[model samples]
Target: MPLVFSDQDLQTHNTLGLPARAAVATLDDESAIPDLCEALSSGRETDAPLFVLGGGSNLVVAARPRRRVLRVALRGIRLWRETTTHWFVEAAAGEPWHGFVDHCLSQGWPGLENLALIPGTVGAAPVQNIGAYGLELDQRLHSVVAWDLRAGRERELRADECGFAYRDSLFKRDGAGRWLIVRVRFALPKAWAPRLDYPDLRDYPGLGSPTGGAGEIPSPRSIFDAVCDIRRRKLPDPAVQGNAGSFFKNPVIDAGQADRLRHRYPDLKAYPQADGRVKLAAGWLIEQAGWKGRRLGPVGMHERQALVLVNHGGAQSADVLALARAVRADVQARFGVDLEQEPVVLD
Candidate 1:
C-alpha cells in the first residue's frame, strides 16, 4: 500500500497557495495502485469523497476539505517506440509537464516546443487537453494508461477513445474519480516545423520575419525559449504572487453574436474557429469590464494579464469564487457572453 497521511496541508501543493487540508494518500509506485483501489473498494477506510491530484497547478481547493486526496506521484520516462514519421515518448504521471517537454527536446524530439512552460503534470495534461501557441496536447497524444476505478483494472486508451475538445477531454468530463492516469504517451513528429501562427510568437523579435522569408527558421529550442519568455513577461510567477494561470477559458460564441459584438466594439479581439463559432479573448473582455488589476479582498485579476486571477496574500476559496463570480457577472452583463472558469474547484 502507498503511504497515507491524515489531514495533509495543501498550501504548498497548489500554485495558488491557498490553505487547505484533507486526508491525503501518495501513490508513488504503479505497483501500489491495485492495493489502493482494493482499499477504497473495501469501504473499510473513510467513506469520504475521493479526489485525484497532480501538480495542483490548475486547481482550487476549499479549506478543510472533507475528502480523501489521492496524490499521483508515480514517476518515469522513456522513448517508448518510434515510427517512420514519429518518435513515441512515454512519461509517468508525476513528471512535471515543462520538464518533460524540455527532456523531449534535448533528445531531438521537437513536436512539443510550442507547449513549453505550461504548468502541471503529464497525467493532468490530457485531462485538460492542454494547449498553447497554436498547439494542443490532443494533436500529439498517442495513447493513455489509466487505472479504471470502476473496472478495478489498468487500461490503455487510444487517442480516439479519449474524447478531446478545446480544453476538455474524456478524463476531464467523465473520469473525475473514476479514472487515475498512470502514464501518458505522446507521438512527436520527426518532421518538425515551428508553429508560429500565434500572433505573439509570429511577431516576436529575433524570430525571423513573419512571412517565413530568407531568415533561418528557428529551432525547437528557440521557440521553446521564446514561449517561456513571453509567458514570464505576461503572467505573474506563482511563487511571487499566487495564481492559477488563466482564470477563464476564452469563450466561444456563435458567429452572429461575435459579429454583433465586433461591430459594436471595433477593438474586440476574436478568432474565427474552423467551425461556425468564434473564440473571443477572455483577457480583453475582463480588462474592458474594468476588472483588470481590480481586487475583492486579497484576490484579483493580474494587471499584466487580465485573464490570470491572483491571490495577493492570504486568500481562501470563498474569495477566489467571489471574484470569479463578480468577473463573470460583469463580463456577461457588458457583452452578453458568459465567461467560464478554467481551473477545477475541489470542495
Candidate 2:
C-alpha cells in the first residue's frame, strides 16, 4: 500500500497558494499506480472524493477538500518510437509540462514549441487540453494511460477517444475523478512546421507575415524563445503573486451575438472560429467592466492582464471565489455573455 499522509497541508502543492488539506498520497512511479488503485478499490463504498493532483496550476481549492488527494509524482521521459513521418515521445504524469517540452526540444522534437511556459504536469495537460499560440495538447497527444478508479483497471485512450475541446477534455467532463492519468504520449512530426498564426507570434519579428504565401520561417528555437518571452511579459509569476494564469475562458458567441457586441464596442477583440462562432476575449470584457487592478479584499485582477485573478496576500478560498463571481456577474451584465472560469474550483 502507498503511504498516505493524514491532514497534510496542501498550500505548498497548489500554485494558487490556497490553504487546503485532505488524506494525501504520492504516486512516485507507474508501478505505484496499481497499488494505489487496489487501495482505492478496497474502499469502494466510501463517499469521500478522490482527486488526482498534478502541478496544481489550473485549480482553485476554494475549501479544504473532504477527499483523498493523490499527488502524482511519477516522472520519466524518453523517445518511445520513431518512423519516417513522426516521433513518438512518452512522458510520465508527474513530469513538469515545460520541462517535458524543453526535453522534447532538446531531443529535436518541435511540435510542443508553441506551448512553452505552460504550468502543470504532463498528465494534467490533456485534462485541460492546454493550448497557447496556435497549438493545443490534443494536437500532439497520441494517447494516454489512465487508471479507471471505479472499474479498478488500467486503460489507454487514444487522441480521438479523449473528447478534447477548447480547454476541456473527457478527463475534465465525464471522467472527472473517475480516470487517473498515469502517462501521456505525444506524436511530433518529423516534417517541422512552426505555427506562427497567433497574432503575438506572427508579429514577433515586427515584419508582417507574407500574404498568401509561406513567409520567412523562423527556427523552432526562435519560436520557443518568442513564446517564452511573451508569456513572461504578459503573465505574473505564481511565486511572486499567486494566480492560476488565465481566470476565465474566452466566451464563444455566435456571429449575430458577436456582431451586436462589436457594433457596441468597435475595439472588441473577437477571433472568428472555424465553427462560425466568434471567441470574445475574456480579459477585454473584464477590463471594460472596470475590474482590472481593482482589489476586492485580498483578491484582485492582474493589472498587466485582466484575465488573471490574483491572491494579493492573505486571501481565503472564499475570497477568491467571491472575486471570480463578482467579475463573472459584471461581465455577463455588461456584455450579455457568460464568462466561464478556466480553473477547476475545488470544494
Candidate 3:
C-alpha cells in the first residue's frame, strides 16, 4: 500500500505553513489510482470531510482534518510534433509547475515564460486556470486527461471543453468531482515566436515576442529571464512570507461602472477584457484603500506586493483570514465592488 497514516507528523507539510495534519498518502503510480479512489470513496461512508490536496500552495487549513489528505505524486513529460509549425507537450498531473515551466523554457517554448516561479503543481493549474503577467495556462493547454470518479473511467477533455474564464474553469464548476486530472497536454509551436503584449514586455527594448506584430524577436531565454525579473520585482515569493500569491481576483465590472470609477478616481487602472467587462487591478484598489504595506498585528499586506496577505512568522491561519475579510469588507464598502479571495480558506 502507498498509504501512510501517522499519529503525529510534522504539519509543516503545506506551503502556507499552517498547523494541519491528515492521514496521508503519496500516490505511488498512475495504475494505483483506482485502488486509491476505491479506498477514498468507501471511507466517505463515515461521511467525514475529504480534501484532495495538490501543491498545497493556495489553500488555508480551516478545521483540522480527521480524514486523510491524499498527496498526488504522478510525474513525467512527453513531447509531440505534427509539423514544423506544430509541436505538443504532455506532463503528468503531479509535476511541479515551475519545474515544468523551466523545462519548457529549456526546450524553447514561449507561452509559459510569463508565469515562471508560480508555486503549485500541474494538477492545480486548471482549477483556477492560473494566469500571470499577461498569459493564462489555458492559452497553452491543448487538452487534459482525467480520471472520472463517477464513471470510474478516464477521459480526455479539450481546451474548449474546460470552460475557462478569468481565474475559473469547468473543473471548478458543477462538473467537478466527475474527473480528476491525470495528465495535461499542450500544443506548442516548433518555430514559435515569443509573445510580448504585456507592458513589461513592451518596455524591454530588445525583447522577442511572436505575439507582437512588430519587433525583432529575441530568444525564449531572454523573454523568460525578463519575465522572471519583472515578477520578482512585483510579487512576493511565498517562501519568504506565507501567501497564496494574489489574495483576490481583479474585479471585472461593466464598462459603464469602470468608466464611472475611472472618472471618480481619475487614476484608477482598468484593463479591458475580451468579454466586454473591464478588469480592474485588485492591487490598485487595495493600494487606493491605503492598505499597501499596512500592518495590523502579524497579519498584513505584503510590503512589495500589495495583493498578498502575509503572516509575519507567528500569525495563525485565522489571523490571515480575518485580515483578508477586513480588507474585502473595506474594498466593498468603499467601491461597491466585492473582493473575492484567490486562496481557498479551508475553514
Candidate 4:
C-alpha cells in the first residue's frame, strides 16, 4: 500500500510558495502502481480528480485543490546500454533532474551538460520538453516508460511518438491524467561536442569559441559547471525567494509581425525559426514594459531577470495571478504579442 496523507500543506511543495492543501498519495516504488490503479478503479479512494506531482518547481497552487495528488517519489539510475556512438542511460521518473544530469556527466556521458541546473524531476522534463543553453531534452531522449490510466497497463513511448515541440510534448498535450510517467531513458552521445551556440555559453569566460580560439574547449564537466554558475547568477534560489523560473514562454510570431516590431523598436531581440516564424524574448518585452523589479501586492518579477515571477513574502495564489495578468496585459498592449504563462496552476 502507498503512504497517504490528508490535508497536506502545500506551501513547501511548490516553488511559488502559495498556500494550499490537498490529499496526497506518495508512490515511492513501481511495484505499488498496480495497487494504486486498483484503488482508483474500485473507487476505494475519494472520487476527487487526480494530480500527478513531481518536484513542484513548475507549479502554482491557486487554491486548496479538491483533488488527490499522487506525488511520484520513484528513484533509480542505470546504464541501460551502449552503442557505437551513444551511451543509453535510464532514470526513474522521480529522480531530481539536475542530479541525474550531473550523474551522467560524472560517469563520462556528455550530452546533458547544457541542461545542468534546471529544477524539477525526470518525468517532468519530457512533459515540458525543458530546454536551456541551446540544448533541449528531446535531443537526448530515447524513450519514456509510463502507466496508462485509461488502458490500465504500462507502455513504452518512443521519442518520435512524444511529439516534442518548443517546451511541449504529447505527455503534456494528451496525457494529463491518462499517462503517469514511471521512468525516462536518454541516449547521450559518445562523440560529444560542447554546445556553445547559445550566447551565454559562447561568451563564457575562458571557454574557447565554438570554432576553437582563445582558450581550451570546455569538457562536459566544465560546461556543466558553467551552466550551473550562469543559472545561479541569473535566477534566484527558490529556498530564499519563492519563484518559478521563466514565467512566460518566448512568444512566437509570424515574420511580418516580427519585422514590424523590429522596425518600431530596432533593439527588439528576435530569433528566426526554421518555420519562418520569429521568437521574441519575453524577458526583454516585460522589462521594456516597465514591469522589471516592480511589485504588485506581494508578488513581483525578479529584478535580476524579468522573466522570473517571485513571491516577495506572505503571498497568495491570487497575488501571483494578478501580477501575471498585469504583466501579460501590458506586454500585449505594447508589443501585440501574447505572453503565455509557463507554470501549471492548480486549484
Candidate 5:
C-alpha cells in the first residue's frame, strides 16, 4: 500500500465538477490488505471519517481531511474455466469498468455489454448494481472479493450474498465504509440473447447475433457500441460540462398510483419495474413541473437532461444542494413522487 497525501482536489469527478481536498491511496499488492487495514483502522487519534473511493466517479467530495481515504487501484484480470459453461473471470477492483467490458466482448463473453460507458470501477459496480439499457450487473455476476476492515480479513462473497436490488445492495443500504473491495468476478455465457426492449437501444438491428464459439456472442459488441452512442448523446460529457449522468433513480409506484398520475398529467411517462411497482421517470416529472433548465445561482438542471443538475462553473456545494432540494420539492408537490440523488454527498 503506497499512500499519498495531497491538499489539492484530486480531480473533478462526474459529480457536478467539484474537487475534493482528499488524500488518495492505492493498494497495488493484494497481500498487503492486512497491513492496510491495521493502518486505516487505527482511527484512534482523528475525528476524520475514513472513506474508500474508486475512480472518483460516484462521489461529490467538497471537503477532505488529512487522514487516509483509500482508492482501490488494483488492476488485473484472470479467468477460471472448469468448463465452457462453468467458467468465471476475476478482475481487480480499480480496473476501468468499460475496459473490462470491452475485453470481455473481444473474448466473446456476454452479460455486461448493456452496462457499457458507465463511469466507475468494477469494485463499486456491485454495491449499487450499476445498470442501464435493460441490464443489471447481477445478471452475470458470480462473486466479489472484499477486505473486511473490522475483521482484519478478506472475504469472497457469492452474488446473492451481496444483496442485489434496484440501485442498491447491502453495501449501499448500510452506508458501507468498512468493506474494501479488492477484486470482482463474473460468470457469463458465450451465447447471445438481446435485451433491447429499452427504448434507447432497441433499434440496433443486429442486437441478437449468436455466438460462434462457447460463450462468445455476436450481439454483445453491437449492444455495447449502441449503448455508448446513446450515452454520448443523452449524457453530458463529464470532461466538458461535468455531471453524473442520471441524478435520480426513477421512483417506483403502484400501477394504480401511476395511472392516476398519468391520467392527471396526460403526458407523464412510466415503466414497469421488476417488482409489481411501476416506475415514473423523475426527469419527466421534473420537466413537467417546469424545473428543467431552471437556474438558481450557479447551479441548475442541464438543458439536455432534466435529471442532471450542473455546476455552471465556480458553484459551491451549497448552491447545488439548494437546487436539488428545490427540484425535489417541486416534483413532490406536483406529482407526489420523491427524487433521490445518485451521487454520494460528502460533508
Candidate 6:
C-alpha cells in the first residue's frame, strides 16, 4: 500500500511555495495502485475528492485543500527499444522531466535536446504538451500509459489518440480527472537534424548557426547547451524565487488581427504558424503593458520575464491571481488579446 499522511504541509511540494495542506498519499510502486484503487472504491479509505500532484512546477495551490492528494513518486527510465531509424525510450511518471532529457542526451539520444531545463516531472509532460525552443512534447511522444480513475482500469494511448494542440492534451481537456498517467514513451529519430529556425538561435551569435554559414549543422549537445543557457538567462530559478514559469500562454490570433496589431505596434513580435494563425508573444504584450518588474504587494511580474508571476515573499495565491488578472486585463485593453493563464490553479 502507498504511504498515507494526514494534514500534510504542501508549501514545499509546489514551485510557487504557496501555503497549503491536504490528506496526502505517495505512490512509489505501480503494483500498489490496484490495491489503493480498491480501497478508494470500497470506501475503506476516506472518500474525499482526489487530486493528482506531480512536481508542482506549474501549479498554484489554495491555502487549504480538503481533497486527498495523490503524489506520484514511482521512478525509472530505460531505452525500451531501438530500430534502424529510431529509438524508443520510456520513463516513469515520477521522473523529473529535465533529468530524463539529460539522461537521454548523455546516452546519445538527440531528439529531446531542444527541451532542456524545463521544470516538472515526466508524468505531467503530456498534460500541457510541454514545449520550449522549437520542439513540443507531442512531436516526440510515442504513447502514454495511464490509469483511468473513473473506469478503474489501466490503458495505453498512442500519440495520435491524444488530442494535442497548442499546449493542450486529452489529459487537460475532457480526460482531466478521468486519467492518471503512470508512464510515457518517446520515439526519437536516429537521423537527426538540428532545428535552428527559431529566432532565438538565429539571432544569437554565441548560440552558433548564424555565424556557421551555409551547410553547418550544430551537434545535439551544442543545441542542448545553448537551450539550457538561454532558459537560465530568461527564467528565474525556482529555488531562489517562487514562481510558475511562463504564467500565461502565448495567444494565437488570426492573421488579419495580427496584421492590424502589427500596423499599430510596428515592433510587435508575431510568428506565422503553419495553420495560418499567428502566435503573438505573451511576454512582449505584458512588457509593453508595463507590467514587467511591476509589483502588487508581494505578488509581482518577474523583472526579466514578464510572463512569469512571482511571489516575492509570503504572497498568497489570491494575491498572485489578482496580479495575473490585472495584467491580463491590461493586455486585453491595450492589444485586444485575451492572455490565458498557463498555470493550473487548484483551490
Winner by lDDT: 1
Candidate 3 — worst ten consecutive residues by lDDT sum?
Answer: 2-11
**Candidate 5 off by > 4 Å:** 1-8, 13-15, 40-47, 65-67, 204-218
Tell me the spans in candidate 6 whose CA falls farther than 4 Å from its real position.
Answer: 2-5, 43-46, 206-215
Write model 1 residue lDDT over 21-113, tens digit each, in one string. 888988888888787678768875556767899999999999988768889898889999999999999999999999999999899999998
The residue-by-residue lDDT of candidate 6 on 1-347, one tens digit each, is 55565788899999999999888878888887787667667777666667788999989898987667889888999999999999999999999999999999899998998888899999999998999888899999999999887667899999999899888988888633467889999999999988777778666555544455655677787788888888899899898999989999999999999999999999998999999999999999999999999999998999999889999999888998999999999999999999999888777
Please report the TM-score between candidate 2 and the true structure.
0.95
Lowest summed lDDT window (length 10), candidate 1: 206-215
143, model 3: CA deviation in Å?
1.0
lDDT of 5 by residue, 1-347 (tens): 43444454655533567755665555677776766667656854254555777776666656554445666778998785536564588888999898999998787666788999998889889887899888889888899888777777889899899989888887777664678888898988655577777877666554445543433344667788888887888878777886766778888889899989878878778887778789888889888889788889887887888988777787766777788889899988888888888777665
Error at 308, model 6, angstroms: 0.9
How well is each residue in 1-347 modelled by candidate 2, as lDDT tens digits? 55565678888888889888777778785676666667667884365777789999988885578767778998899898999999999999999999998888888988899999999999999999999998888889999999897787889999999999999989999745798898899999999887988999987863322332356667777778789999999999998889999989998999999999989999999999999999999999999999989989999999999999999888878999899999999998998999999888767
lDDT of each: 0.91, 0.87, 0.76, 0.89, 0.76, 0.88
Q: Show the colliding residue pairs in model 4.
A: none
Per-residue alpha-carbon lDDT of candidate 4 for residues 1-347, written as tens digits (9 for 90 to 100): 66565778888889888888888878898888887777777778556767889999989886678667888999999999999999999999999999999999879888998998899999999999999999989999999999987667899999999899988898888845677999999999888888999999888887643444666667788788889999999999998999989999999999999999999999999999999999999999999999999999899999999999999999998899899999999999999999999888777
User: How much is 166 displaced in model 2, in angstroms?
Assistant: 0.8
Q: Which sections of candidate 2 miss by over 4 Å?
A: 44-47, 206-216
Ranking by lDDT: 1, 4, 6, 2, 5, 3
Candidate 1 lDDT? 0.91
Candidate 6 displacement at residue 110 in angstroms: 1.0
- Give TM per candidate: 0.97, 0.95, 0.90, 0.96, 0.90, 0.95
TM-score result, candidate 6: 0.95
Each candidate's clash count: 0, 0, 3, 0, 3, 0
Screening candidate 1 with a backbone cut-off below 3 angstroms (N, C-alpha, C), the clashing residue pairs are none
